[model samples]
Target chain A: MTTASAEKTAENGAGEEGYNFAYLDEQTKRMIRRCILKAVAVPGYQVPFGGREMPLPYGWGTGGMQVTASIIGHDDTLKVIDQGADDTTNAVNIRRFFARTAAVDTTEVTAEASIVQTRHRVPEDPMTEGQILVYQVPQPEPLRKLEPREIECRKMHAYKEYGLMQVSLYEDIARFGEIATSYSYPVMVNDRYLMSPTPIPKFDNPKMHDFPALQLFGAGREKRIYAIPPFTKVKSLDFDDHPFEVQQWEENCALCGAEDTFLDEVILDDRGGKMYVCSDSHYCARRRAEGHRGTLSDSAAAAYAAAVGAADRPSEDGESAEWVT
Target chain B: MAAMATLAGSAPGGIDTTDLKPGLADPVHDSQRVFRALLEAMARPGRPLQLEEGLDPPFPLDPATAAAVLTLCDHDTPLWIDWIADTPPVRAYFSFHCGCPLVERSQQAAFGLVSDAENMPRLGLFAQGLDKYPDRSATLVLQVPSLSEGLAVQLSGPGIDGRETLRAAGLPDWFWNDWRLNAAQFPLGVDIIMTSGRALVGLPRSIAAEG
Candidate 1:
């Protein structure tokens, strides 16, 4: 139904050239908006929506893009990030798409953006009130892996029967001596529903609890949208003895020297050479700008700085240098 | 002059057609703003939101309801209104601006508009959707006397930090009883948007309402 209308609107020249404003018709936006309302009303409850197919593929942040397109306005400054980096290929493409379709301003700075669309990681920077965070979810249902059938999953949610999930955690502990799940960790929102916080590492899970910004999760492939309102309760699922824990490293970011941020282990060569750097590009840049230095060598630091500068500058054809590479 | 004469000639009970002119001035921006307010109201249940744009519908329709219908109702949404708000002018106004189809049965309605909260239909009358697709349930937009300074109801649920007290005037005593039952239904009950003057308070089905 959406594709037919999109084609019709494209032929009619409703929006910029062929595409509609933000690439969705007003009716689709209304439908998604109603779904969003219900999702927010029942926090962590996944609401089924008529998820529309974007120009991009489903797994590549299509759901988050749809949510952002629906709520974003001309005045909103949009920030798109992949694995907490603004210069990643997926993030750059999404940012450019919205910038062209909606004609909205785009920014890399977390504090300046009114809407932040992310995949895999939430920014280390705390979001203030009125700012919205849209998460691109591949799987909205946390129990889908355990129970593949949708009917059974719905019944389980209705009955609050989370024994399967608990059993899975127990099995993981029995095998690995600890909870094996790392990213996409399940959380109980408002102490009612068990929700999947996407693929964001378990390290970023604590940031979700009592968050000031409204967090929206959209899964295009799963055809679901869920929400965590501002200051809402979010607890990561765990047993009493096996409490939830985040990944920790002995070294700080190679460029920023930040001890708190989630670090990514980058392999410089095929040999045993590896360095720990901040997964959040913006956080790392801000720290570097503040004159923070790590144990990185002078040549390696200079190369990193050059790469960051090149990524920030848009080429003459309006594409970021990161895209070409 | 001709259009005005024709409109007046077709008027029911000699009611002035000129006075029944209240709709969104700017459809795009105005609807967006109203939707944002509604989103906030739903996310934070039992919290009162002062709608920035004041709408002037006929006598019975309040500003908040007017804004809600304008923003939410469209061609896709099937709206059902009570007899009090099912007047010709109100119907015509919504039809012209929103293009929403009016449904005869309340159960078929995706969105419902109620002018009289005290004598409104039972909660079970509207669509509760199915268990698999609970979001298919109806959203009720009810008009009350006042949003504040009335009977205090304790609300605790997904949105509330702990517990919050809400006072809404001109509601029947049985409303709380019905709300408790509705909340028990979990993902299968209708959500409510209460409008009084230019303020709105959302009471989603997830909220546990106690007197």
Candidate 2:
């Protein structure tokens, strides 16, 4: 074939053979970058842009991936997590995707990553300066639940008319004796606009306040991006009498004995046997490596140990290789 | 061939275009650095950020403004240049390098360049963007004499913890009055970037500016 035909064929087969650097063209990146700058300029204000459809589905972290792609360089280390576990299927898929497309290093450790894309949880570890946390948002507007009309929500945000949100919270209190918003709790950004902190549980809401790392939220389906610069104030919406509170658990992690971390309840069988473990897999594993034993029975601990050992094995393709325990 | 050579040889006013300078040497990396600096400047309003200096645009264009224009503007962005910078050579340079169309009306521009801040178009002249998407508003990049040697103005808003004092010269006395009117609109106002030498300070619409 001639050189021209070969180039045409390559262009035709771009997706299967090779993707653009980080899977986004430079023009698209520039557009998103402009939106990001504006979002940073006006904290908690959602800046709309032309959100591109990624190779993955819309609900599957396409937003976070795009933000990561725009900001990531060849030298950056990326980490992806779903519900705070690095070994989940979605996290592994995203990690593998970036590994192939961008050729950047991937890590499971929270502190080692320069960029962390998360779906529903912020890592328990404190992020240092220069690190960026990208959250995949399903809904960018905090008032969407109350007002379905986009125009009305815009006006409400414009005139600082947040009475509907307060009424909703008051109604929740009247019904359940507490604010019923467990995840995706609304928070005020820089004391200006009310923002939804994605779907992270209320337990992680405190981490968004005065955070050292810059936080960027992208909603691909909604075609919006917003930001909270480092050290910006974020206050969860609440009344003085009914202050904000996180979920409290009576049991520590069954595997790592970490009482401070967010815990996930796991059922052993059809019987009444149950256990609580850290939702963050890396945090649990690091504690286990540090020889922090928990309340797991002997056989359960041994079985968990074997599973972790298998997960640490080296593989031929490094993309699917076991995550660091 | 003669016509083509003439078109390329010199712009209007007999300014030779043979030795035209380059924009950021490495477009991708350099633009990323510039964007980072711009992001910081916008996030922390009233704080001066020193930008990397390499661009060599013609006279009347400050280094910071030029760097910002080159980094942010593309064919997609419509640019509006003030009277002082609406020259043929500068227009040719922008059209050739950035590919952004020069607009006559400030309201239509995605980015506006002001060479003379004292005579700049009124804040109401530019697009304040729609209420739904206020980010669509134009970002005004004003070239000033110096950032540190101006009248001290107090700014208080989202980025500022309490209030910040900044010295920005080269603006009309009525600018602060206009800014107050602009801030009253909240989510709907033109954001300003003051450039002097290689430094820039952002004044986002959320800020309350008072002398």
Candidate 3:
């Protein structure tokens, strides 16, 4: 995923052949910047901004792109990931979009990237102080599901009234004997605003607390921007008896042979065979290159590589040509 | 530079506007850099970032504050300049470069600049925003003497890791006392950005300051 960074800033006029640098006009960037400041000023508090339409659709990391476009500079190294894999279509297209539009350096190695735009997963790597992590949020409001009314929700946030949210959590505990929420876990930022963690698994919630990197969340369709500045307290909302716990797996990552990382279960065949591989593709690859091998890694490595490669290029003839003939 | 329209007597309140200066050399990339600095400063409250934009904005505005004003403010944001900063040249400079409406009252401003921090208006005078809409408050940009040479205070809050010290001189005797009252408002208070020379430190509403 780490493409050899080429020097192309001078040739592209800060963007591709025609578009403005980073694809956003100066004024729009200014507007977004000001909102970002406000969001930082009040951590975890969502600040509404006049969100602009991006070339991509609303759900496909458009909010993250807008935030990236606003803050990205010529010298910054950009990296995009969908569910922690840089090779996925959403990640690939977005990385290419910035490479062409923003004319910024691109990398896949988490440490090398200055501004990382992510969806569904925060990188396993610990980001440094100056690095920025931009999250694409589908819903900026944490209480929207409970209250539904925007005005009522606003009032609740104003007064720090979160009894409804706590009641919903209690209901989850009563039904499942434990809190059943696996993702999009609610958190109390700075012990003030209850914020939605944007569907990132509860496993990543602890990483946000006192993390050195600045975390920014943008919800394009919702027209809201929020932030969690570096070193802020992000506590998972939970009772003492029913403590917040992240999902744990009995199996380690089959690809990386690691006991800690999150694993994605892949069905091997129709005969009930399954393999648990690292959800973070780059991390798994790095581990494999360091001579770490799982139970089936030696046998399945070529097949997995071929499958990912096949997904990269479409059938050139047509969809019918692959199956019809 | 955009066409310098020196509207001598056309400025509000009958201020001469002939002497003006350019905002930024490169509006697009320059502002992005400036905004990143501003964002970083806001995130790490006591930390100062180097913001030498090579700008010479009118009599009152320094490079850091000017960079912030030029990058953040627009026609949509109503701006206010305190008496010390509300000079004819300052008015002319903002009018030509920023085009932000300069409101007479501090409460009406989304952004404010205070040249004389020691004698500036009280914290309550500016927009404290609303309960529902806290981000609608005013962001005051002040030119202080130095970030390290002044009254040192311990800051611990959202942005600070544990405890960071903030030092700046020339603020009024009532500054910290007023700040405490302002912080009592929680999500409904003004944010301050102090600039000295080419450096700046952001004092957002969330920071808890102690001497």
Candidate 2, position B59, lDDT: 74
The whole-model lDDT of each prediction reads: 0.84, 0.82, 0.84
Worst 10 residues of 1 chain A by lDDT: A1-10
Query: Candidate 3: deviation at residue A87, Å?
Result: 1.1
Q: Model 2, residue B151: what's the lDDT? A: 91
Give one digit per residue, the lDDT tens place, for model 3 in A1-325: 4454343344745677677888888888888999999999999889998899998899998888889999999889988888888767788778878887888778777989999999989898779997999999999899998889999999999999999999999999899888888899999999999999999989989999998999999999999999999999999999999888888898887766877887888888899998888877767777877888877756576567456542223321111113111
Over B144-193, each residue of candidate 2 has an lDDT whose tens digit, in order, gives 88889999999887666567888988898788999999889877888888
Worst window of 10 by summed lDDT in candidate 3 chain B = B1-10
The prediction achieving the highest TM-score against the true structure is 3
Q: Interface RMSD for each candidate model?
A: 1.8, 2.2, 0.6
Clash totals, every prediction: 0, 0, 0
Ordered list by lDDT, greatest first: 3, 1, 2
Candidate 2 clash pair list: none
Model 3, residue B139: C-alpha shift (Å): 0.4
DockQ for model 2 equals 0.42
Q: Which residue window of length 10 is worst by lDDT in model 1 chain B?
A: B9-18
Candidate 2 chain A least-lDDT 10 residues? A1-10
Candidate 3, residue A22: lDDT: 87
Poorly placed runs, candidate 3 (over 4 Å):
A1-13, A310-325, B1-17
Rank list by DockQ: 3, 1, 2
TM-score of chain B of each: 0.92, 0.91, 0.92
* DockQ, all models: 0.51, 0.42, 0.86
